[model samples]
Target: MPKLKLDIASKVLRLANPLRVAGYTFETWEVIVVTLDDGARRGRGEASGIYFLGDDAANMRAAIEDVRAAVEGGLDREALRSLLPPGGARNAIDCALWELEAARSGKPVWQLAGVPQPRPVVTTFTLSADTPIEMARGAVGYVDARAIKIKLTGDLALDLQRVHAIRAARPDVWLGVDGNQGFVRDQLDALIPALVEQRVSLLEQPLARGEEAALEGLASPIPIAGDESIVSLADVTAAPSQFQIVNIKLDKCGGLTEGLLMAAEARRLGLGVMVGTMIGTSLATAPGFVLAQLCDFVDLDGATFIVEDRLPSVAYRDGTVFAGPDVWGSGRP
Candidate 1:
């Protein structure tokens, strides 16, 4: 371990357009960028905390400063978990360590993480919750999309109308619904049937975070993915009862280190694993993109939602996303 100089900067990344999800509307995302400099080599990481959880960039910056001494003292990812509880602060630092190690070891992040040779992963493009006509038009607009996820706002009739309109518009793409913790237990009974009828494949976080118990014995044909409900490694163990799939977001779980553990734990519990991201630039999505290789499903289009993305960024082509060595986890400055 070597002593390192740590630098932190906060940035506000403007969204390409207003994004309306279940519990919030976003015009921009505030992200924290952490850089680790070990003289000749440098590693950088970016993180935007879970906004719904009140994990914003200001708090993340303060959190990192609190542990600045330990980080500069050659802190490793394993020790970082105890220093900073899972959130944006830990996520940014943890990812920075991964990139640093990759640079030092002369290996790519996927290689360091023991993943097979990387491949472009097909991901779901999400449609912001809106009126039926606009939502349908949005679906039609994604000409290259092979899979689409619809954001629902817990309104039964209106949500149904929106779903049906999109389904009618793009019958060819695989469909998934993200309630963003906007639906209740009873509503899911009706909603699941309608979603199934519309050929929807995945249902994500239909209920609120503390309401996981409500889904304990509920049965459904659609695979329910735990997003807000599963934040850290502990949450992954408990997710199987409520969710068929666990969505791993680096910022939410802290970083790639915990993310890998969560994925393994979810698999051990026989739950499917998916990778997702918040509305941030390529830096925020790159670590998640590396973790995406092990996922059963991927939602790495966070960078696509931003107005402008980082250079040498991750690329989306033919409905799949990929990050070469230069984008992240390659130890490039």
Candidate 2:
């Protein structure tokens, strides 16, 4: 089969609202979109902000341009990896291949990759960190939400207390906390118990990445998911003690192709899977919805933080994401 050509484009889509996390504030969502053209059909893929990996709109655009000449002439996914380091650029290309392949083969991205159709998955509504009262108020505002994922920097004592306050305010809501690499092993003794008592369902990347070995042989009351720690399939097996579940993001794992591989490998290693996304418009979150199907927790609500969204945004009805294959193109198997 003759190889298809790849054309890449990127832009900084200004955020409709400010997206606040512990260490970052995004006024705009930068995204890179790759389209693989076979002259008759086109496959599209998109990626959002990946600050942890030193990726922004400019770098991702340059990364795509760095490989465009070779890609235009026809380069496979593996070959493209050599031209680009693993980050948003590789992610876009890898996903483009999946979508392109799916389009050419007349299969949905899931069917092409042997993944089943996505079921109706419930997502975690994130309550951004702020003043204790404000945080508590946010939790209260989401009173009807099925589950809540609280964002926290270190400050274990205060954060735990805030959780208690939130729980006190809404006793029936399901709760999870994302430490975002804000805790040390020493703090776990105090932190884990507090989170557990509050009935926290999951704890995410409490410790920094590459510090996984520190958690060896330690046990906690709640499940620990790896967000910053697991970026590739290789990282999946490196730390057994550090994480019980893995958070897969396309921007981190190079793209949907390897993102799928990492998820499979993490599962093989007995790690639970969570699909997450960087803050952006629906374009960024759309491709990530595919991962949500196989994951236990879905955190693709990045766009929800934004005030406005691109046209034909992925529909979010009662916290459930509904996007058809053609909405984002079924990446090739």
Candidate 3:
């Protein structure tokens, strides 16, 4: 093995439309790209950190630089777990390692992870938090989507109206709501019933972190998913008691290596798995697609928000994402 060479670059991806969620609105995706060269083969990865979690492209790049010497000395994935805490930096390096291994061994990442062959996955098209009328209009464009994830801002009346409007517009689409940790326990009393009325099948992170205990014994019409509540393995152990689903984003739990472990642990705890993504290009979403194969819900539509994606990008159509073989790490055995 030759000394590994690393290159990092940042890009700003403009969204086709501004996306308003719980506490923030995003018009651009700031991402950091990592490329690792091992004398012969070169592999690449991308990461867009969670801004609310205090992660940014600059810090992610610096974190990667902190591990430069170890990576150049041929550090493996297992050692990577102890080297970095879970975040965007580990996510980029871990994914780049997977791509590097695939390039060297000629095996797909799915095969290396002991997962079955990859296939087209039905993904949730997201509706950014907007007025009732605007959300309804957004639903019209995704009338053919199998599932839709709607963002909520914890306002009882406005949120209810938004869901009702979208429900009325797309009666055939399965609905899931993400509060983004914007709601409180008191709001669930009124919000739960309204969500049920709208036929919402899943609810994500209704209450903020540290408030998960409020959901310990509470029962509702829809299964609750843990997004902000769960990040690393420790959070997974506590998730089953609070949520029925766990939203696993590669950047949140480290990378595909940790994500696979988290999914298995979530299943062992009898929790459904949801593979999600931060707003990024196809390069960022491609690795998450592998984990979506094992998830109950696939939320890998991050690339859809961007106006343009990296060349030879993942193909998304009719709500399904197809990872083309030409893309790095998407190969088959």
Top lDDT: which candidate number?
A: 1
Query: Candidate 3, residues 1-333: lDDT per residue as tens digits?
Result: 568998889999999999998889989989998888987887788999877788899899899999999988888988999999999999999998999988888888889988868899999999999999999999998856899999999887999999999999999999999999899999999999988988999999999888999999888869999998898777999887799999999999888999999999999989999999999988888888988889899998899899988888988887798786676595422
TM-score of each: 0.98, 0.91, 0.98
Candidate whose TM-score is highest:
1
**Candidate 1, residues 213-295: lDDT per residue as tens digits?**
99998889999999999999989878878899999999899999999999999989999999999988888888888888899
The number of clashing residue pairs in each candidate reads 1, 8, 0
Q: Which of candidates 1 and 3 is the stronger one according to TM-score?
A: 1
lDDT of 2 by residue, 1-333 (tens): 456777767667676446556566668766778788878777776776478767887888887877777877777777766677767888888777777777778778777666678665677788877767887888777645777888887887788777888888778878899988778889988988888888999999888877888877778869888888888667887746678888888888787777787888888888888999887667677668877778888888777777667767877676577666546655433
lDDT of model 3, residue 263: 92
Worst 10 residues of 1 by lDDT: 324-333
Q: Is candidate 2 or candidate 3 better by TM-score?
A: 3
Better by TM-score, candidate 2 or 1: 1
RMSD of every candidate to native, in Å, equals: 0.9, 2.4, 1.3
**Candidate 2 weakest ten by summed lDDT:** 324-333
TM-score order, best first, reads 1, 3, 2
For candidate 3, report its TM-score: 0.98
Evaluate residue 168 in candidate 1 and report its C-alpha lDDT on the 0 to 100 scale.
99
